[model samples]
Target: MKRIGLTGGIGSGKSTVASLLVAEGAVLVDTDAIARSIAQTGGIAMPAIEAAFGSSVIAPDGSLDRVAMRQLVFTDAGAKTRLEAILHPLIGTETQRQAAAAGDHAVVVFDVPLLVESGRWRTLVDRVLVVDAREETQLQRVMSRSGWAPEAVRAVIAQQAPRKARRAAADAVIYNESLTLAELGTEVRGLWKLWAAATTR
Candidate 1:
């Protein structure tokens, strides 16, 4: 299988491009979804999370209290490191398992929002496909879609890798800032054709 590392900044329309790839029959391994699954109630990572952060970060129903954890991590620099240590390995293992299970000729796209920051994904995939957009475009899209304040959207954007860095890491980039859905799909299909053709060679 050929593996593609798909990534983008928040609100860059990475998910939309991912769906387009799926429509082209790409097998997707969404790391964010896996992370959420592992942090949910009765999840594999819950016990370790409880051990690391204690019961305060756990909801009454036993799931990770995302709001509480987010607040804690924001206040404590070490808290984010601790959380990543717990989560990254599990996410990586599951991600690899899914990719390995793909058909021999399949094009497996790993949709990782943090692929640039992770420091390891670049080495794992055959190519990196970054979904790109201007920072102001990202801020507006996030605010409109999520109903978040501008500052709140900016704060989230601040935590992600910079546009230049993500573009530098990309084997290909889809500039998504001003494109309509149809245009975006067309772009993704063109790239998917290239990747799909490469898999056969």
Candidate 2:
């Protein structure tokens, strides 16, 4: 099996691209979804989080209050790192297990929002495929889609790896600006063929 890392900045339509890849028969492992599951109330990462950040991070329903945690982490770099320390290992283990179970002939797509930021997982994949868009587009998309203030969106973007750095690190880039879903799908299909050929070699 070939492990392909798919990444992009927030609101760059990475999920949309991942969906297209799924339609192309790739086995998708969404790290964000896995992290969310592990952070839920009484989830694998909850004990460590509660210990580190206290019970305030937990919701009334016994789930991790994602909004509260997000607010806390965004303000405190150490807290963010602590959270990552707890969750990254679990996410990575599950991702590897799933990829291994996919067997040969499967294209395992690891949809990671922070692939560039994490840096350590580059060796886990055969190639990095980044979905790219202009920063202005990203800000607009984030504001409209998330209903967040422009400043909030900008702050989130500020914390992520810059577009130039991400592009430089990418083995492939999918320009997402001014592209329709059909166009995006076509591009992904083309990349699928390329990835298949490369991995087979």
Per-residue lDDT of 41-146 in model 2, one digit per residue for the tens? 6688888878888988899977889888878888999998998888889988888888888888898999988888888768888899999999999999998887
What C-alpha lDDT do the candidate models reach, one value each? Answer: 0.92, 0.89
Model 1, range 1-201, lDDT digits (tens) per residue?
A: 789999999999999999999999999999999999999989999999999999999999999998899778767889999999999999989988988889787889999999999898999899999999999999889988989888777877888999999999999999998899999999999998988898778
Report the poorest 10 consecutive residues by lDDT, candidate 2: 40-49
Clashes of 1: 0
How well does candidate 2 score on lDDT at residue 99?
84
TM-score of each: 0.95, 0.95
- How many pairs collide in each candidate, listed in order? 0, 1
Clashing pairs in 2: 41-63
Question: For model 1, what is the error of residue 186's alpha carbon versus the real structure, in angstroms, after optimal superposition?
Answer: 0.4
